[model samples]
Target: MSTLSIRDLVVSVETEAGAKEILHGVNMDISSNETHAIMGPNGSGKSTLAYALAGHPKYTIDSGSVTLDGEDLVEMSVDERAKAGLFLAMQYPVEVPGVTVTNFLRASKTAIDGEAPKLRTWTKDLSQAMKDLRIDPEFAARNVNEGFSGGEKKRHEILQLELLKPKFAVLDETDSGLDVDALRIVSEGVNRAKETTDIGVLLITHYTRILRYIKPDHVHVLVKGKVAEEGGPELAQRLEDEGYDRFLVNA
Candidate 1:
């Protein structure tokens, strides 16, 4: 059964000129324990799809419905969506200078789960997760993403995925701007998250490097704001070998 479903989704953004359509009748179904990768060139509306799925205010859903585990996701607020088992790891993680990572995690857990994590048990789990991700313990006490490097910011996003364990996660370009080592670490964290939970993954990326580590069960080509093509993992290899020209032509 699909954990998340987007049916005939149409989204537009408001600009000074007028409403500009970004997604045009796109549909997808992601199932539990499945990893799906959406790949497309720049301006193909990949990130727009992610934001739209998360119910971002900027991207207006012109029509269609989005459901999470058969629940109406389109009607829920962003925080409600999170509480309803949907998570979006953004392309650009925001930095808050005053909020420590520990505090942020606790608050998010409380908000999503309806109560704060028990101090003794939650901290132990948090420490173990940090250690597993190779993040220093002291980093938790520091402000969230404030002084973090690009890779560190990505790791912090993964940390939340681990702690929160949402039912479905839309990771927008999680592999961007990371060195080889950081990529592996981040991939490992993603793998760990999958092992610990039955979360479905929708990874949006341009590069194929991350796929080498975190193999996708399915690969989709997004072009002209829609899925131009889709196939098993071999489709990702074809894109890696031959580039997107063939797909663009069909798109």
Candidate 2:
């Protein structure tokens, strides 16, 4: 089984006041087939940890190391990290104006795999994944995320997750803006990817509702950019019942 390890990770971002640290010594190890949920309040560095793992230029690694299976992820370029089997589903997916969804997914698959998927197999898989996500066939022709609703954009993110087959996925608040129906659909998509590929997941979210559907193997509460508590799925239930009130006070 592959492993994604985060050890004492310290990350920062530029602000009007200059460099400001966000994540403070965050650490976790996720293996294939394991799901870890990161629950935190707003500005608690949940997204910062996600983007830092994905090597976003906006976030700087002040110290610590991220490795996938033994290779240094922090040393790799963004695309290089992706090629190394890392994926991030952004909280707010950006619009790619001129790129059709079909073209974008196909090109991304090509880039990561280093070869174009055979036309027949590629077409079949693409059709199946889109249908599974309940995305309209017409979406294949539309520009990536352009003019799409919140649910539509989120579905498109899962579409890439399903197709790209990454080893590890850090989903940044994917449950946000999803209605009940959309939530179930998207959750199913995530579960499908995990079952099929044994992909490690670091799911970042505020609410425990998504946990009900996704069933995290482990739950971590991040307060003030640090892990305040860690436990099994029961921890998520407690967070739901008690909320982060106690943790915020301690933070």
Best by lDDT: 2
Q: Kindly list the per-residue Cα lDDT of model 2 for residues 1-251, writing each as its tens digit.
A: 99999999999998999999998899999999899999988989999999999999989999999999999999999999999999999999999999999999999999999999999999999999999999889999999999999999999999999999999999999999999999999999999999999999999999999988998999999999999999999999998889899988877
Every candidate's lDDT? 0.92, 0.95
lDDT of 1 by residue, 191-235 (tens): 888888978999999989999999899998999888899999899
- Superposed model 1: Cα runs more than 4 Å off: none
Give the root-mean-square deviation of each candidate in angstroms.
1.0, 0.6
Cα TM-score of candidate 1: 0.98
Q: Mark the 10 consecutive residues where model 1 has the least summed lDDT.
A: 242-251
Colliding residue pairs in candidate 2: none
Q: List candidate 2 segments past 4 Å from native.
A: none
